[model samples]
Target: MKLKRDFYLQDCVKVARDLLGKVFVHETKEGIAKGIIVETEAYNGAIDKASHSYKYKRTKRTEIQFGLGGYAYVYFIYGMHFNINIVTGIEGEPQGVLIRGIQPTYGIDLMKERRKTDNLINLTNGPAKLCQAMGITKEQYGMDLCNSNLYIEEGISIEDKDVDITKRINIDYAAEDKDRLWRFSIKDNPFVSIKVKS
Candidate 1:
């Protein structure tokens, strides 16, 4: 079953941990592709120092991040790659979780077509890469995940022992914040991208 609307960031930590084994499904004209969420990173509210809303300020790019939870806050960085984030925390509090990686469960051929490479190694391993593979874009910003064309679903139930937690990737610029250690993932999901340099 798909996640219920009531599952929005009521408890950010629990939500992050629970997402470890959930299946995230995205449907497009190309086809339906599903992945088991194997990795994630959480950003807490304005005071968390690691969140984009740290100053409690809003910009065209961050407005959606400050709104309701469970919405998509897709954005572009490094000029080309789209990074997909799921808004979390209480409304107006402005926190979100970055989906870092997933294990492909459906439409492997379609993912290969969009990525232009049959190498599963590069398929849906990182955030920006997954967005490309799934056809998500900035146009999806603020779209409600609970009801949008692209949404997360509860596919396979995993035991707590199967999930893993570690420091997030690619935030060395955050300094002391780098030690916050908030990344979560499945212990051994093959679809996760490991060759990419963070």
Candidate 2:
């Protein structure tokens, strides 16, 4: 079943951690592609230095974050890749969870075609990679997650013992907030992005 908006209205950290093992589905004109969420990172707006809306800053790129929870915050990065994030928290609060990794569960052939590879690790191992493999683009920005073509759904239940927590990746620029343990992954999940440093 599709997750309700209330599921994303809670704390960003909670939603990020709980998102592991859920199914992320994206339906496009080409076909339906789905994957089990294996990794995520939480960004608490205003207070989170790593967030685009940090200090409550609102720009055209971040305006959607301040809207109601359960929306897609798709954005282009590095001038080439697109990353998909789920907006969370109440309207104007601007918290979001980055979907870092997913384990392909449906439309594997379609994902491989889009990614141009059959290697499981290369399928949807990172946020940008998953967006590409799942045919998600910046056009999906602001799409409501609660009831939209792209949404998360119930999948296998992940146990606490099967989870691993670590600092987020590629955001050392956040300074002191860089070390915060906001990244969560399913323990031993090969599809998870990268191994957390010890």
Candidate 3:
């Protein structure tokens, strides 16, 4: 079953952790690809220094986050890679959950071809890489995940013992927020972007 809007209308930190073990599906014109979410990072809006919408800054790229939850916040980074985040919280709250990694379960050939790699471990090990392999891009920005082609589905039930909480990656500039331990990933999941202790 597809996750509902209410499923995303909660605290970002909770949503990020809950998203693990769920299925992330992106049905594109090329084909449909599915994967099990294994990693995620949460950014608390308005107050979080790591968030683009910190202080309620509403630029073109960040305005989507200020809307109701259950939307896809796709953004371009490094002028090359596209990263996807799930908008969370109520209107104007602007919280987000970044899907950092997934293990491909369907359309493996399409994912491998998109990534130009035959190594299964390298297919969707990172945020941008998973986006590429799944054919997700800026075009998917602000998509309503509750009803759109891009959405998460109910899959495996994740237990507390199977998850590891850690600090986000490469956001040391967020001051104390860098150590907030907002990142969540399945323990021992080889598809995770980074390995860190809880």
TM-score of each: 0.92, 0.98, 0.98
lDDT of each: 0.79, 0.93, 0.94
Error of 3 at 187 (Å): 0.3
Instruction: Count clashes in each candidate, considering only residues at least 3 apart in sequence or on different chains.
Output: 0, 0, 0
Expressed as tens digits, the lDDT of each residue in 1-198 for candidate 3 is 999989999999999999999999999888999999999999987789999998888999998999999999999999999999999999999899999999999999999999999999999999999999999988999999998999999999889999999989989799988889899999999999888765
Model 1 segments more than 4 A misplaced = 194-198
- Comparing 1 with 2 on lDDT, the higher-scoring candidate is 2
Q: Write candidate 1's Cα lDDT for 89-168 as tens digits.
A: 67778888888898788988998898898888679889988888888887888888888788898867768787776776
Clashing pairs in 1: none
**C-alpha RMSD by candidate, in order:** 2.3, 0.8, 0.8
Q: Write the per-residue lDDT of candidate 2 for residues 72-107, one digit (tens) a residue.
A: 999999999999899988988989999999999999
Candidate 2 backbone collisions, by pair = none
**What would you estimate as the lDDT of candidate 2?**
0.93
> Over 4 Å off in model 3, which ranges?
none
